[model samples]
Target: MPRTFDGATGPVAGRFAIVVSRYNENVTGKLLQGAIETLTQAGIADDDIDVAWVPGAWEIPLIAQRMAETGHYAAVLNLGAVIRGETTHDEHINRQVSLSLGELSLVTGVPMLFGVLTVNSLEQAIHRSGGNVGNKGMECAEAALQMVRLLAQLPE
Candidate 1:
């Protein structure tokens, strides 16, 4: 069953750090917009959100990890898009970035939401970024908010 967020007794307002990749500008740009919109809608003040830019997908994890460990933000959002190419390089990057971000979240105990999109082509990435598949950035923002609330309730 799907779990529902109980915002009445948890941390609902806090700082957020978003790390975005500049590689796929078009798709990533749209994703960033979606993420910001979702965060705003969730009652997070604009000034409380911090946005950082990285060169590409592989760099997202490291930046996000640093931000998550800073103890400033309630959560960190990692946004990137890795589209498959003729070479196998895409596979390696996708795996490394995804795994690294997951490990960072576990090690830091901070909610690091994975907003990376691994797709076969730019078109597919676009579709997920803000098209038919729905906006992954918005989804990531929602996940972050929910996680922040949940984490606040955990026994310290």
Candidate 2:
């Protein structure tokens, strides 16, 4: 069974940042839309949510770290798409970005959620980005909201 957090709730009424990648614009754009929509639906005000664009997946971690360090947001979401090519470059980028983002979340204690999609091709990326498999952005938004609630319960 999948994990759920229906009982989780807290003061996530304002201030969230989303760092999105410019690469794979089409895919990333849809992801952005889904994220924005989910957050809005969850009662996060438009002005309270900040969106930033980066060059690609490799930049997600750095941008997220900066956003988290600012202490201006309850949580940060990292969005990107890394579709595999003939070379292993995609693998390296996917792994590095995911790991770095995870570390950023731990080091900052700011609840950074990874929304990057590491797929085999553009088609696969599209299929997951608000397509057949559902939007990863929506999933990420939910994760960010839940993390914010969880962190709020932590002793600070």
Q: What TM-score fits each model?
A: 0.92, 0.92
State the lDDT of candidate 1 residue by residue for 1-156, as single tens digits: 966546434348889999999999899999999999999988899999999999999899889988887899999998989999999999999899988988988899888888999999999999999899999999999889888887776668
lDDT of each: 0.90, 0.89
Q: Score candidate 2 by lDDT.
A: 0.89
lDDT of 2 by residue, 90-153 (tens): 9999899988988988899888888999999899999989989999999999988888887665
Model 2 is weakest, by summed lDDT over 10 consecutive residues, at 2-11
Runs in model 2 lying further than 4 Å from the true structure: 1-11
Root mean square deviation (Cα) for candidate 1: 2.9
